[model samples]
Target: DSQKEANGLRTDHWVMDKRHSTYLFFMGVGEYAIVKDKWKNIAVDYYIEKEYEPYAKQIYGNTPEMIEFFSKKLGYDYPWAKYAQISGRDYVSGAMENTTATLHGSDILQKPGQLIDENKWEDTIAHELFHHWFGDLVTAESWSNLTVNESFANYSEYLWNEYKYGKDQADYHQMEDVNHYIHNPSDFKKDLVRFDYASREDVFDLVTYQKGGGILHMLRNYLGDDAFFAGMNDYLKTYEYKNAEAHQLRLSFEKVSGKDLNWFFNQWYFGSGHPKLNYSYTFEPVKKQVTVIVNQSQELPFEFPLTIDVYDNGKPKRQQVWVNAAAKNTFSFDVSKNPDLVNINADGILVADITETKTPEQNLMQFTGSKEFKSRYSALTAIKDQVGKNPAATKLLSAALKDPYFRVRQKALELMDLSNADQLKALGADVEKLASNDPKTLVQGAAIAALAKTKDKKYLSVFEKGVNAVSNSVKANSVAAVLAVDPSKANTLADKIDLEGASDELLSQMLPIIVKNKVTSEMSNIAPLVAFYPFLKFQNPELGKSAEEGYNWIMTSDNLKATESVTKILGQAKGQMGENPQVKMMISQMLKDGLTKKMELLKQNPQKASSINPQIDAINKAIENFK
Candidate 1:
């Protein structure tokens, strides 16, 4: 955790290798740590590490329990001989099921002496373990066959989370995405099936997890639960210890279900876009029926369930129907009462945008009035921008803000965006208390962040005081809160805080905040000015032209201070980065872009032109590019 590395210390890096039996086997140390516990299991010792030791232990203990749980449920023994889970420190790439070892980003790693929400942590642990059977034991042959790997892993998480934490906690709509789940075309230049991911960051996207998992769940609903698991068993038996692609998996399921499933995968996965619907129908009281015609178009071609809530005298009665085929999926409901409104997915069943038509105001009033904690929580989550104006409108929410659920209390604390600083401080203090009570990291982190944003000096002092006293995780949280409000605090702490012989945790804490602060406050200003999304630096044929143009525009803008920083950032690009060809090209193009800027500046502001090294160097580099 030292602030500076010892002179000549060797920094380790990772590259993909095919030397192992696993789909991806990786090794790295120093800045990149794999913190799994090593154990003696048969001939070869097993080493497993997560972001933290306690979380690793927790994950380890649960693996055997989950293995036993699934084995009994499936009437089959655990497939893998030895299991290990290693959580990445800030796992932007996502959790991977690599043979006996499963790796997840370490941001989810819970610290020792920190109280954790039993449900959420366990669900993540369970989700990865479920992969032992579906992904590790029987691997996907190619990344293109994403359905076999991600769908199974994701659905397994949902089933386990639902069973353990209830259907609400298995909430995909808000926590994840509703649009991608229903296949919205708004962001489909990045296709769900045929991948074009430039980096690992894009692989763990919602299209892979939420969309894939939701479709798989629907598949189970279409086929009986018995048939679904039986199909899984058949698929596993057919392709154990080997890689099978998407078509192979479809064939396996098709055999067990005795149904042609090619159309199912093709329509959903291979297709260009999703279904969108627009409809209107009036209820006739004499007929004692609710007749609603559904209108759809191939704009989305989405086939997901739409629940209609029939309200009579401000009370709701719910029913579900399929909004199938983008063309027009229509059905009618008959009842003695003429319903005031029809709400689609009122309970947030399927993840889709609420754009068809507005639900009844009375139903919303009832929802806001009810004391059901989940209802109040849902309303608060759904109304992000509208809540502040309708504070009185949300009865259950106002009451829920005082409710026992720590998350509920925290959310209530968050809504105190009053113009008065004292009001914000009061809410911040309450959130500080709730942070101790709530074991949820997201809630606690959100509370701390919101409190820090108050920008009051007294609040900053309170946060600093909290950091000085609390245990590591709690202290780290307070530090994070302070950093969010004023990144300079982290820099100040880095300058003052002694890192010499400090524990890895302390260094770990400092490095990320420092890098993040630098990225936002420092480097971001610098990167775009001197460089193009440049071919010499980050050369993707697709993005190079746009990035280059964007950088040129930024440099010519009137921000002189930014212009100075940009020159320095571009200077770094003149040298080598790594063997990655794209990296080289991007650096060159950025330098080239910077050179053009120097030529203009040389005539406009000659002294400033000489002051900026990259600009001067860039002027030379531009000529070299053409030469």
Candidate 2:
């Protein structure tokens, strides 16, 4: 209770069993407003800052539902006396699962409309909450086996997404995770359960969080739903409040499936990298068969068990085959007729980078007729590489624009050509429709941004509507689109942006537009030039480039006052911008160019150049001092 006692102060004491690790224990006391709720018989407390007290419902109100969902799903009850979450303004990471108490970053405390984009963090909450079971209760035996905890917690994000949203949402998240791991320059072949380490912190990478989660997801798919969940329940029951290694998890699944998981565990957990494959298929009409040749080109080979689907006359015939660890592997399937298309890894059973050498006609069959989302995605990628004015590619992309999956539509929009008016005229209706009516905010944002590439005025109305979108990304894209269609209106659109609350992304996009329109005078009234001028040293290359252009425009303006403002910003940012070579080079070039222009004017009108000598000398001094 918050009531004061005879001691002139209120005291609240809470305790939990000593089953959790030392790192899992947490406590905090401050001027906080406690929001209370319940799940079954367990009490839940959401401790939030007094300023964010009213938003407690929007931030942590769903704790009970998540607890109930996880409890029922894991075949376990709430393990602690009370489940409490505290929103800390100074918290570093997203959130930490501390036995009975979880600490959330202040980003979770959103007010009213802020919940529109901010509520997308429900997955993060789900991730930390799942650690209560995977990390707090059944912990990793050592830092080397961190994947045992982080991977399972990451997988829980997909589980909740699949359970509440749908398989499509879960699949999208899986693909995103795969993309992050694959695109990283680091080696993917490291063993997830190895003792080799640089430090404990090295285990907290994408390999442990994303790639590990992906492997677990694949294992679940391989074991089937019933067996997988049964094995998980057994694993949790056996290791409650205890630390476990990766092999123990393998043993649990092996016991449930009654099969040796040596190939699965050794290749995935102990293996270093995913497969990089190049494949081609041949259809022999006389023999009525399809032959697929796959080549493994990575440092180490991977054994891939994949489903191959052959499409003939719009009908799919599925076959499963294993590709051994060989440089070259071949598989032939007997069919009644020549196959129109062949899909390898149609079920997405393996994580690998696959390239297909198929004709547009063959790919269109999978693009339009394949039942599996992976098959369709692969077909889209194959066709996306060959995107052009080709009628077949255009038709396939147009068809893909209407796909039920947002990712497919997003990819199509990305690959679609809007280089000229004719192309936009052909695909404009679909693109405009998606920009205006797509249910997914990301897809709509992509469509809206694609308009900026066209630079055609026909889609001005679409861009105008998108400017008021709920998503900041969509709004940023809309601003660019408006400027592209009508450069004169950049200042008007930029003026409406809430510069104080604007995200770096929105500011980055708007900055370039404002520079191109030469609207420094209009922007100076909204926000101080110095506040944005330092973006010349921004970490993002694009933001730095835009800021450089903005700086150059202000320096080159005919208005002497604007040019003087540039000098002041350069002076203010001298020491900070010195470390960045790009910013220094840009400033050096601008000063050199400005000094040359002033000298040229001096040859024509000696009196004006004499009057501007002080400004010229200052520019020269700033350039000389460039680090």
Candidate 3:
């Protein structure tokens, strides 16, 4: 142990083996309660705030179980002396894995009531722990190959969820990542194993984390779980306590699976883009066969493998096909019976942009009958986009409102558009029930916001109660519902809520409402919204963008008093926000932009120019100070 200080600060000191990298060293000093447990011969400790001591088991009691699972799953012993995790306030990232000790954000300290939904720490906690084996023990050769460290850690979330929370949760987690990756392909135009990054931080992106994890998932599905795990154990054993590159990992998997993987690596890891695909299928009932043609729209086409399932009166028969490395590929499969509906990406293995052409009847069947949540989710989402109201689709949406999964119910709420008088008549009662009684806050919030569109005064009580609810998410969204029903009440409601404890959701929701209604007459209430400045500009840049637009709207609202108040707010921020260069730059830009707009307004109407010249001059002086 490091020397105990004279003041007794309860410092923790843990040494790392010389083989590990220099960055793996860990130490912390704080007022924390240490909870201890053991997995075989390895000791585990969780250090948290004293106030959170009672909920320690709910928060991190699974550290020992996780260690045991990962050790056995990877066929690797616990490499470090002992393991420790602590929570810190205002942590920059979610969590950081240091050799023997991990530091997490204060959000990990949750009360027992928060666990009624699901363990918030499930993915992140398992992610950091997996780094001990993949990153801390083996290490990546260089910043260029960060996916070597991060990809495995990202994949470990799936492994842990599968081992502990069943495949439904694990598959749902993977579908979320795949959705993030496929929907946001612009972020991953660079090769996964690229070497020309401008900065190391640029390497830690959705591509390295989510896309790489999705690729590993495809690999696991490509080679069965046994082969994939065997390959993983071999790779870890070969690269233990030594830095390794992408090729070394490929060679290990290739050695265990006894198959060449250069084709897979060249198309995915070393490659630059994924396949944006669209497909159409034609079934010939007389021959009991289906012919599917897939077209690639990406600049660089990828040869992606897929399992196409043909449902014959609800019984599924699957056939493997490849969207070959070309502009377009075709496949035909002989079925045992006439197919009722076709499911694309049946296993949801590969991350690609896949659109399958199907009729409304086929979509309704998939939404009701598909076993996988992603399939049902995709079906319902596609149905939501259709223009005409089909009674069959509406019936499916009504039934899906009671889906066991919250996301499914949320989608059902979104698809139940009350703007359509037909839909309003069919599902209004069900929507009211969901708004009041849905178990998930997100679903309830969605239902309440949607119900507001009906202009039903009876649901006003639900919105009023939700606006004052304990959950910040519910309160923020309910505020939106209230504003939707009666825009006149925004100013009074804005004054009542405590802005200090309000979330970005509330700020982002209410900022536009208050600005639209010219609610900041006294300017005293505006200060709380201004506190969000400089900080929110980076933390939630979109909300920050919205704040900028709202501020611009206020300045040009033609109310000199309100415009003057905004000017004073910017002037106050000029001095207090100069420490952060980014914040300083943003404030300067806003001042300059606001000044230019004010000058333009004065040009349009010379009568009021004289009244506002002093304020304009003051803003110009503030701009000079920024220089």
Error of 2 at 20 (Å): 0.5
Pitting candidate 1 against candidate 2, the one with the higher lDDT is: 2
Per-residue lDDT of candidate 2, residues 86-193 (tens digit): 877656567888888888877677654345434656777888888988999899999989988999989998898888777767777877887798888575757878
List candidate 1 stretches off by more than 4 Å.
1-55, 58-61, 70-75, 86-95, 103-110, 113-128, 172-206, 247-263, 278-281, 300-305, 324-326, 335-340, 347-351, 356-378, 399-412, 418-627
- Give lDDT tens digits, candidate 3, residues 1-627: 657767855455554545888887767778899988777887788898998898788888888888989989888877887888998975766889988789898768776434433467768889999999889988999988888889989999998887886676777888888678777757758888988889998898888998899989999888888888888888888989999988988998899999899999998888877888788778887887888777888898887678787787766677788777898888888876667787878777778877676766777788777667777777777776562368877877877787777778887886677877888777888888888788877677778877877766777899999887655456656777887888777866764443333444455666766665555543333434543455667777866665665667655544555555555556655655647777667767877787887787778878987766765876687677676
Specify the highest-lDDT model's number. 3
Model 3: number of backbone collisions: 0
TM-score of each: 0.61, 0.79, 0.76
Residue pairs that clash (backbone atoms under 3 angstroms), model 3: none
Output the better candidate (1/2) by TM-score: 2
Which has the greatest TM-score?
A: 2
Ranking by TM-score: 2, 3, 1
lDDT of 1 by residue, 366-483 (tens): 4544344344455555554454445332433345455545556556556655334554533545565555555555455445555665655555755676465334444655776667
Clashes of 2: 4
Worst 10 residues of 2 by lDDT: 522-531
